[model samples]
Target: MSVVASMGRKEKAQGAEPSIAPLIELAGPDMERVNALILDMAGSNADMIPEIARHLIDSGGKRLRPLLTLAAAKAFGYEGDNHVKLAASVEFMHTATLLHDDVVDESEMRRGKLSARMLWGNQASVLVGDYLLGQAFRMMVEVGSLDALRVLSDAAAVIAEGEVMQLAAAKNIETEEAAYLRVINAKTAALFAAACEVGPIIAGSAPEMRAAYSAYGTNLGLAFQLVDDALDYGGSSMTLGKRVGDDFREGKVTLPVVLAIRAGDARERAFWKRTIEDGAIEDGDLDRAIGLLRAHGAIAETVSRAKAYGEAAVAALSATPAGPYRDALVGVVAFCVSRVS
Candidate 1:
């Protein structure tokens, strides 16, 4: 079977979401350290702090960002504990964003469970997310590399900015594809780039190597987000954690929606405006929406675009030291875009 088929079978047999198990296995020893640090830092006397934090932290989403950090460090032959700190910090930052995102999106579900906001309330979720951010910064400082600190800190700012941009673009039927790319680039890809770059930086790799990893991560991130957006329409709820068409219900304009909107005729345009911009959704709208997307080949086109970025991610690794870690990184790109299959 092909890689995608093999992955699909594994997921079905295990009754789990598709995973980057190869990368995780490759970084097993380091990931154990990262997990321990995560649990350690998640502790709190406030009770609710750790409660709310762990609720989301223990969610089943694969720790892909942190894995990238550990794998990158391993690829560069780093033999220090700083990568552990950085990896934990990367995970904290990612978790914090997820907490905040669920609240902002008013999402009811996350990773196959009720969202933190649904369980605790928006106020508690936001505060716990803030607490995670504080802990993440502290971890970055403990690593004691100003360059690593700068990279992660910058990514934090970019992620917040991306959230705001997505909010602005929300329900705006006129949002362009470039605008969509920018939102996902900052919201998602920025962290991926930072996670990978910090590894090389802490490993004392040359600047050229750092840039190569950053490029690899950025492109990989872009592809990952595109596939996710497509999956929101085409994938099963078991695969997505939340119900499919959450984006449609929320009126979030992703790349597929963008392409569909641009190609739609007068009647189709009215349908998009009413359902997406105006949120006047009704039964069968989702099926109709899927029909429109298929009619325009938006889903296929989005996957095609993802494949291009995946190729770029593989190309960015040309300067990365050749080894198993390097090969696994390339496989990560393949696995990311293959979710659609």
Candidate 2:
């Protein structure tokens, strides 16, 4: 049940065409409106906030948060302008998190460019992130949906809590799996749930359908994060648009390393103690750690968990009617896992 091996999708779709093309194609029509809304939401008037805010936005993330909103809304037959505002709000919140995350993680690069904190300094990054959150809240209010606003507000709170938890857990090798789930569920899954739920809420969908979308997005976020954890310990750094071994260097307990710590032999335990626990591993330590992960089946086990989450994401779509949007939603989860692996 290695994560990559357990995904139930047909192969060869990964060959010539991008696995996410179907999702991108299905979401193409809403792109213009989404782009326009994002710009409007991002456009702000603060002394230095706009510069800090624009740094990562210009670095070109895929805006998958908004895409999730649009796809879910389309699946449920939403044809209103409110969805646009809601989608833009989700993007704004996501960007704000990235800004604060860089500051907290003390990250130097993001999306292969200097982080906002790097470009504008921490004070500017923090202020600008706050400004963006304010703007996102404004848009949420403008949408005139109490449910959507509450969802976003709670998500913002949860995201902050998750960040704090991660900061506390840093370099602490004994951090539990439950702790990891708590951090990721808030830091990652909250917004993802809001992104999908906002669409259904705007569409005035059935309760079951709304719940389905939330479950789908939540599971997808968890899967997305598991793959990310695996990649930080497993993927080539240059290919991932960031330096390799960042989590290791920072002493973060990503899934692969966590599994390796539990399942690895004495040498592997020594590697974790030196690199992760002691924070004193040298050159090739990262490579050797990755090697151990592969040899001990830790990486495979972690990915299997990711794939199970992916399968749950796919099954969540069963509550939605059969449509291109539904298939694309399922496909995106697979693509999210594969793209990282």
Candidate 3:
């Protein structure tokens, strides 16, 4: 059975699945300003910059990262306009990374559409990503909060490091779970942590509160990525925004593959080495890979781990005040993990 189908109906009905609508409703006004700022900043004298940038920007992503920034700030009673700027900066940073990532992964689709790299070419995609990064920094400086800038800049550096680490680990069947976690922590969770932390920083919240938001974002990001990894082998293309098995096709060593390799017999090990380590995937290979992942319960275990991270993310929010904002942030974590359930 599919992952979602495997879940008990009682679990699904008991709020095991949640909506981000609460977070969206709570941050409505600020998100409007953030959306406007994003559009304004995406503009440029050079036509191609905006063209390439808007193509991806216009694609219908949930804008969850920037919303996290806005919610964290509003949760702490921040009243300044700087939160808007920081929200835009977070989004630009995210968009820039997606642009670069598509190129790095040689991905052809994003958000159910052709990727920027597929249409604009890798050179243009990379350059426009650089442009977005420049704009992200400019907005960060405009905020004039050194703490926010430092957090975001540090995340940018760490994201680059994560990409490099993933590149090195790619197609290596021996990649351990700890090494995989490190890669995702850097590439995905770093930005999420920074995005949530900057809000509390700009609000001048207590150090403990700031740390709480950072931890929440970090755990939420881990859950989000883990779900994505599981969905790649178990979900539909529409839900994935790309083909299922794309990770397998690319020879990526995600958690499911790692676990399967550990539990697999000697003959199965040869199959993985031939397809992943050797990059010799043939027809019917993706089906075989998925079958093995299911046989070993790797996908189920990956989802279980994601649920643990989601629970940790919700726990981190206990440090924040109990209100609609905190409830909504908790909802965000549930929404992320629910994709698999």
Question: Which pairs of residues clash in candidate 2, taking residues 3 or more apart in a chain or in different chains?
Answer: 2-304, 3-303, 3-304
User: For residues 281-313, what per-residue lDDT tens digits would candidate 3 score against the true structure?
Assistant: 899999999999999999999999998888888
lDDT string, candidate 2, 1-341, tens digits: 23334443345454442266777787787867877766666666664665666667778767888889888888888887887778778888999898888888888888788788887899888888887788889889998989888888999999999999998888776777888888999999999998998888888888898899999989999988887777776677655567777777777887777777777678667778888878898989878988888887877777778888887888888868889888878778868777655
| Leading candidate by TM-score | 3
lDDT per residue (tens digit) for residues 1-341 in model 1: 24334544666688765447778889999889899999999899999998987888787888999999999998999999999999999999999999999999999999989999999999999999999999999999998999999999999999999999999999999999999999999999999999999989999999999999999999999999999899999999987889999999999999999999999899999999999999999999999999999999999899888878887888899877999898778778767866886
- Tell me how candidate 2 scores on lDDT: 0.80
Our tally of clashes for model 1 stands at 0
Question: What is the Cα-based TM-score of model 2?
Answer: 0.92
My TM-score estimates for the predictions, one after another, are 0.94, 0.92, 0.95
lDDT of each: 0.91, 0.80, 0.91
Order of quality (TM-score): 3, 1, 2
- TM-score for candidate 3, please give it: 0.95
Native-to-model Cα distance after best TM-score fit, residue 29 in candidate 2, in Å: 3.7
Q: Which candidate, 1 or 3, would have the higher TM-score against the true structure?
A: 3
